[model samples]
Target: MAEVATSASSSANSSARSVSLLVVVDPVARRLDGESVRIAKDVLSAGASHTKVCLPDDPEEFARALGRRGSRRPVVIGDDSALLRAVALLHRRRELAGCALSVVPVGSALGLARSLGLPTGAVAAARAVLDGAERRLDLLVDDSDGVVLGTVGIPPVPAPVPVRAEAGSGPQGAASVRPWLRTCQSLVRTLASSRTARTAVAPGTPGPARLRVEVDGVTLVDLDQPVEGVSVTPGAAGVAVVEVRPLSVGAQASPLTASGRTVTVSGAHFRYRADAVVSGPVGTRTWVAREGAWGLTLPAE
Candidate 1:
């Protein structure tokens, strides 16, 4: 996928005024603070003209807070999943484009949020909510209506169930070493043509399954050909596709790559992990992109 982002020129006065803001602190974040939640609250309270803080206990309450946020900009204080939840709610209500969103990343696996250009620090991110420019960005929405903020992959082995952690548990702080390892992992993923992520299988695990794949309505691989693995990620230009071939008795394995607007995968039941969420065990799935579907608030260039 080509890098998928677009920045609108900032309005001359975007950062000049203190705007009214609805700061919804993710329930998960409230428990994980390690001081991050407090810093976020204090910073946002200080920066906005009128700040209303809502701490929703569950997804329903979270949605209600957003639906009721009249004129105040919403600032999410949680990790990527919390941001994903907010985006999905607003998208379903068809109000996403009309509402620019901000985030104060505060959980494990903050990489996706960071990769989206959000400041990883709670204070910095909260401040950006008040002073940053709004950017329109693309999203990958699957037929199931699930939203993905980052990469999607069909690893050679089954993906692990997503782990949920209490906010500041073992190396859970925003500056913890886990994210550093994740950064190195992401680099390895890139340098290894993504096989480190897409073709990972533990010993004793079953091998990859063959699946038919279609890109932009064009067939990349048909069911007749067996495949070791496949991956689909939303790139700036389009959806990036990769197909890993299993090594033959005498031939080396080769991976195929391509990009398109939509990608379809069908075979026996398969699963994929998209951002922080996982979906499937279904026979087929399709993911399509809506260019510039929503806005993300980020630092002005």
Candidate 2:
């Protein structure tokens, strides 16, 4: 399959004289700290003459920049978050079918990027952007129009609290912070102040909301039970896999799988984490597996 995709991409490239490229850089990527950005800029400039770089801080700006690119292929320069952002933008615009996407991991939260086998450094990643082969990938589109490319969940751990210190505090004061300490701190603060704490319906909670899930018009899991979380993922031969993890203390962990093109999830209002960001408190959401929706460049094994 990889060979076939590569051949097709080569064929497509042969007929095209010039390729327009867009480099969307997320300023916050950890590697983009001053010096790294310079190195990346130099490498990218050397590779493609028509490349245009833009830094978009938020989703709205990212989408707008992509829209302006028209037909050029987009290369995202950031970590998994930036990659996901690019995919979401393309999916929302219905342009995923036409554009090929590439990524350069540049942040601490680059787990997904590594999982996809993307290059961790700037120069190697830039070379991949220029010479890599393209392969079509599945995208999970939620009913609420949100798109994700990774696992989603509502974690059981309580959010962390922010530590307040006086001005002029030295390194000793901040030495205990972990890699995701800021995110943990924010989540803790949110949980404490929120009037209604939204938690997964697990062993300690009230109970799981009764959910009515249908896959390609067929009813699957319909029960009133405590659920830790729900996820919809892509499966073999372009199917939408659905799973529900029940709330239990160390019960066996199993994810439900389904093969279908469309999935509809409807139940009581609840918040859902899509990719890495919390998306909703929606009552009903639907997801469709858009097979071959977009193209990505993965590292050669």
Candidate 3:
């Protein structure tokens, strides 16, 4: 009995130490920092029981390689965008909840990866991937099937343009249009909207916008009040921290803040920055914070 127990313990220890990895090296990371990528690959290969490195040239190939990872743990060797792409892919496939994703941050756009407690250096990140703990983290998913890893900001509002009436129509002409007609018109407008505003609008410049901000079905700010900007970020325990900077008399006022499971923003044509991407002149968007929706491999505490 004693001998059998000792043999079982040894097998358990071996099982704990052994790991199989599928390393996907982002093309952008290769072009920008090939040395770091090489180092990461070497470390991961030496540490893991088995490692298969894939060099996918395009986005489709990247998706395919990740999709066919089989039983090997997928470790992304790239920047935050690459990590996000991997996460988004897994989320879309409904596999994120079951996967423990790892990353070796290797580009200029690594803010999101670093913010999530991933080591910045290639060697450190790779080693952590080999001997790390899997942590379940919160996620903010928008109604459009978009995801935000960190902060989501509604950039400075553009100057509002007045809707004009038809030549023969009166002042209420625009309002007289059927609700469905108005929606159709806005849909067309949204489709035709130029995305240049994503880069053009700076973070804190103030242009007043009449946006209705809601948290969990409760209205925080209605269309009656003009707001300077708004931001939403996932908070602890499946809540979203929201802030609305309302335009004040003569000077900017303190932002109104709230926390909840869902946040909604609606207004005239507007664009928002989610992580590093700018999206939408959307008429309305709602985001829900999903607690512990995905797992990320990080250095063990």
Candidate 4:
């Protein structure tokens, strides 16, 4: 009888103290910085009671690995895109509510992770994964079933062009042109084209999009006014902060701002940048803030 009681107590204690983790190392992250990935893996393996490491070579494999995590705490060692992919997968599976995620920021693009207050250093981030607190965070879900952890930007930002000219184009063995000179040339060309491109119908070159912006069923900006851009960010208490900037006429008009749980934008096709990804030329879209919808592990304050 005493032996049985002792075994029961020992089993209970072991179960209570056990920590199992699933570490997913993104391929891009490994290619970008193998050392950081190694450090993160080492730290997490040593700290966790049991750790299962997975090196996914592609996005499909990455999704499959995370989907099979089972009951283990999922830890991602990758960049902003990888983290977003992981969150998106879980959200799609309807498992976010029950899963708390940890990340060791390892890619060149760490802006989103930094904005979320995640540790950037591999060692620190991994340590936090081992000994950290889970905090519920707000999420923005769009009509198309996309999730945004940070801000949504309208008229998506353009990608940077390569400064160096392609080889074999310049004179044989000629030295490469200076990047600043190329930038100035590009700017001059853009300005010249803009002037020529302006028409009587549209005052500005690359005319502003006519979008209807609504917040919580209240119309803030209509199609009558051309807007330069629109931005939406998830705020506390299940609200989203929205802003619509009108195209500058003779004098710049102050942006229209509102706060609501739902934000809808519709009109001529337009593209938007959500966190790091640029998506769609959709005619309409809506986003709602889900406060405390998901959990993330961060360093304890």
lDDT of all predictions, in order shown?
0.73, 0.65, 0.81, 0.82
Give the winner by TM-score.
4
Which residue pairs clash in candidate 1?
A: 1-235, 1-240, 2-235, 2-236, 2-237, 3-236, 4-236, 32-167
**lDDT for each residue of candidate 3 in 44-159, tens digit (9 for 90 to 100):** 87676667788888888899989988998999999888998999999999999999999999977777887999999988998899889999999899998888888888873343
- Candidate that scores best on lDDT: 4
Question: Measured by TM-score, how close is model 2 to the native structure?
Answer: 0.72
Task: Give the distance in Å from residue 3's predicted Cα in candidate 2 to where it truly belongs.
Answer: 36
> How far off is residue 246 in model 4, in Å?
1.5
Better of 1 and 3 by TM-score: 3
Q: For candidate 1, which ten residues in a row score worst on lDDT?
A: 1-10
Model 3 scores a TM of 0.79
Overall local distance difference test of candidate 3: 0.81
Model 4 — TM-score against the truth? 0.80
Query: Which is the better candidate, 3 or 4, if ranked by lDDT?
Result: 4
Per-residue lDDT of model 4, residues 28-124, tens digit only: 7876677888898877766666778888888988988899888889999998999999999999999998999999999778889999999999899
Better of 1 and 2 by TM-score: 1
Task: Write out the backbone clash pairs for model 2.
Answer: 143-286, 159-188, 208-226
Error of 2 at 144 (Å): 2.3
